[model samples]
Target chain A: MSDPILEVKNLKKYFRVTNGVLKAVDNVNLSIQRGETFGLVGESGCGKSTLGRTIMRLYNTTEGQVLFNGENVHQLKGSRLKQFNRDMQMVFQDPYASLNPRMTVGDIIAEGIDIHRLSSGVKRRERVSELLQTVGLPEEHASRFPHEFSGGQRQRIGIARALAINPQFIVADEPVSALDVSVQAQVINLFKRLQEENGLTYLFISHDLAMVKHIADRVGVMYLGSLTEVAQSHELYRNPLHPYTVALLSAIPIPDPEVERKRERIILEGDVPSPINPPPGCRFFARCPKAMPQCQVDTPRWIEVETDHYVACHLYK
Target chain B: MENILEVKDLKVSFHTYAGEVQAVRGVSFDLKKGEVLAIVGESGCGKSVTSQTIMRLIPSPPSIIKEGSILFDKKIDLVQLTLKEMESIRGSEIGMIFQDPMTSLNPTMTIGKQITEGLVRHQGLSKEKAQKEAIELLSLVGIPRPETRIKQYPHEFSGGMRQRVMIAISLACRPKLLIADEPTTALDVTIQAQIIDLLKDLQEKIGSSIIIITHNLGVVADIAQRVVVMYAGKIVEQGTVDDIFYRAQHPYTWGLLHSILRLDDDEKSELVPIEGMPPDLLAPPQGCAFAARCPHAMNICLNEDPQTQIIQDEHSMACWLMDKRMRTEIR
Candidate 1:
């Protein structure tokens, strides 16, 4: 009913190699509503991360456009670009590698505040202390370096830094994958609480299906460099349409021994094909159990097979 | 099932500049012959250290096995064995599959050479004989075009294929005991499932006892017959898979079960994460190691560690809440 907060239109990102052109993100289209989390999931090297980077304008797009609030994100410059940077923020995967080891926790959180001229001096210090308390960290930890804190605490600092800018949209690339299970739950809960309190939209990127199912409102499944399915999170998990989505969902092992032992897993055969100079047909044709001869030559078109559920597969066609 | 490996009161510590990091503190467990035992724990909990210590792989000086005995096959204390003696048993009698297949494999060596290296040394096979056997081993792990793929280097293989190669190399000598430390951690969910299935299939065919150390509870349930939950370098709970999943008694175990998002779990259920961090191993708590983060910690739990209480057959945990003596105090 409301205008989408972010719209990605036929986006493509490619890298030239000595051998050939590697298609990292190819012809992806997506729309995210305001104040809702859109989860993008795929296995390793599936271009989910590349798509996130491209949407964030970290990488120069090969083709197509990214629209944020009806304006081309790539075309913005000067003060508008600065405003865009403040409005849109990113949370990286590894807190150890992302945060500056030399900077104190206060400095790390205040960097965004100072850059945006949101506060200065004592006010900046006060804001940093407030953020620390918001994320469940002690204010005394502000002066301490990141190395002194544990993995979970460091991640909370990272979240604090992202929240410092008061961004409306955040692209979290595998934010909790590096954390331990108990710590992961804490961080995921933090993300949810922050989203509710800030009225924020998130593009949550991860390879973990269960976490995506738990945190996201809408879910997209990426294969190779293309989206194979998009649906409401519960809808996708309950009745996955695309062959790839089915295989991907079934591959996740349930923690309960009874459920895991009773359920028959759909273990797809063979490795994912190389993204460089990919085949003309469907990317999943090699491993799809329901693949048809036509699927080997013609790529399936993305279509809405049901209300609010989209799939790209000949089986649905 | 008879015991294949018995580790009793194993205390391993690392001498660091800061202090002595007690990595594995008083850990004791046994592996039944042909059974799969999964050691489940987060990082810094010493699951990896415990498994590597079984292989005598940790270098000395920095690491010291302060106390305990690692008895193999009801005799032969592995902790007492010299490096030279351990080498004889390393590949032939015991094998290990490391976490990262990419780095674990030698980049320059061909897959065939890597696989045959163990067969040649441990089995006294000729170069030609070992090479032929290497092809069979690769195919046995479900790798296609074994002859041609064997000649290719590690970089040419994908992550899953490289993991398969690692499995082939580990099973080359058909060791009686295999320790796989996070064998599928680096791979994708699909590849992880494939590797798990491969490990399960091969374990049945080889009839060797396996010690799988991983943080993934799902993978443990999929492959392991028994589970051990570790915290701060010590095991807090251990039981059969059914017991750990259905009737777990430890508060720490409950936290783990509640924290993880199971595939079948409804979205409405909230995760009850453990509140605090694991205790520093350099100066581990005198009480229960999990007491700092545990929700059911009692006054005694802060002063003294609870003894292991057997909740049921083959299921035990170290927690004051499970002790009947503490029930009166709680009332």
Candidate 2:
């Protein structure tokens, strides 16, 4: 499309471990438009969260570039980066630890506003109250501490805080995984509402493919730090070319019993290989049902199997 | 198909200084032999307590099975059984697997030792026999490199590996009925699929019924032959999986089904979340607890709790909307 709001090119992050090096995020590329939710789905320790933090520069990437508004975000220094902070905000998965427990809800949301100097005194309070109401919570909840609220309420508070900076983009890292299912639905719809109201760009990271399918316009499937598939939500679900995507989709329990019984199952055999020593070729080869000799010899290059649908599986190649 | 286990008019309450919290209120359901029964509900629905009570696993004083008869194997009433009898039943005739493999496992023990411990102690098998059985269990659960992984600590295994290990340990004695409470909620989608498939395979190999308790509608969708919908400590709906899925009549079931974000649905691109929180169990409404949030709530819904009305075969619901009196009111 036209210049993306955010572009990540061959982003990589490695950790020096006793075993050798942990390749948390391998050569990966993706883009998020100005007002779109780009969902990144993978299991725990698959480096989805690491990727989000890396995009926000919370974790320094060992290699690759994160472009914000066509500018390399990694290169921004001092005052220049401070301005970047004003435009982007983040909400963490664990609400219990994400927000300062000691701080009142009002103070937590206001902390970002004060840092950005977005408003002052009564005006800031009014803005904070407005944000709270927007997320389907009362302004009176602003005075309560994080513990005072239920898991769902606490997440709403976190959402309120993210909106405090009036950010154009938000990195929501597994934002609903820890909450109850019904409450998770609440937080998810809140995100949708917030997106519509603010015209915000989102890098939604989660292991819940079901949740991702609900909010995301486009989804990128990751395995061992590498992207296996990226496609529009409708197209991907309807026609998942990648073996991993097929397995993941089949695995999701469709609330209907008849469909569930009849739904073809793809049971991957082996666990995901460690990122530090991801196999010589495709990360999914060990578990892929359609893996061939070519898959074991070399990693499949990301190719467009259909219009706007991308997959890095030898089956497509 | 006879009832493998029957829970009749179960009432569980935890006595606390704050007051006795009515955790489970006259909840009852039956699990048929060789049939997978899923207890589905959101948090604080008393599914866990009900399952735990069947195992006589609930600690007393603060927690008590205030009233109910848990008929296991058509003869043994678990609620009346003593600690000694419960111990024999556990891991031998009935087994349980909890969520969060990290906490469920013994950190001090190796995977092999932990798995074999239940076999050796409960079944009275020799250590040598138990060790061999443990290895077999590990392999059966599809834990590759099982021989080596058995010696590894819980920390050494990945989350998926650890969960498989938990399954291996739980199935050591091959209990007739296996209770897996939110077993795969903490696992990734791919790994979760593997685990679910493994459970299904194991169940087929050995003719054992499975009871999967989870809030995830997606998880219960596949393996559960029948499903029970719980809310605020009572079963709001119970029926065959087909009945629950396609023709769920209860408002709560409709809300639950609609609320869940399914990966399989294009319509769920924007998941319609149910507004308002579940009622506090300590103060469950005199009428239907879900009446507060029910879109089609009638005036009688707030005045009286509807009886469990049967609709067609094996499907039942508790809601004023389904009550014959409400039908007349609507007319």
| Best of the candidates, TM-score | 1
Instruction: Give the per-residue lDDT digits (tens) of candidate 1, residues B11-93.
Output: 99999999999999989988999999999988899999999999999999899999999999998899999999999999889
Please provide, for model 1 over A1-317, each residue's C-alpha lDDT reduced to its tens digit, 9 standing for 90 to 100: 86699999999999999999999998899999999999999999999999999888898889999999988999999999999999898999998998999999999999999888999988899999999999999999999999998888888999899999789999999999999999999999999989989899999999999999999999999999999999999999999988899898888888888787798989999999989999988999999989899999998898999988988898886
Q: For model 1, state the Cα shift of residue A281 in Å.
A: 1.8
Candidate 2, after superposition: displacement of residue B314 in Å? 2.0
The positional error of residue B109 in candidate 2, measured at the CA in angstroms, is 1.9
**Per-model CA lDDT versus the true structure:** 0.92, 0.86
Positional deviation of residue B134's Cα in model 2 after best superposition, in angstroms: 2.5
TM-score, candidate number 1: 0.99
True contacts kept of each: 0.73, 0.82
- All candidates: CA RMSD (Å): 1.1, 2.0
Query: lDDT by residue for model 2 over B1-331, one digit each (tens)?
Result: 8999999999999987778789999988889899999999888889999998888888887798888898999999999989987988998888888999879998999999999888988888998998888888889988887789888899998888899998888888888999999999888777788888888998999878888999877778778889999998999999988899888999888888777766656575556677899887777788888889889987888978878888988899898787786679779
User: lDDT tens string, model 2, A1-317?
Assistant: 56589999999999999888899999999888889999999877778888999999898889999999988998998888988998889999888888898999999999988887879889988998998998889988888888887788888988888888888999999899888777788899889888998899999998887778778889999888889899998788888888888887877777777777788877777677777766688888888888799888897898888888999987765
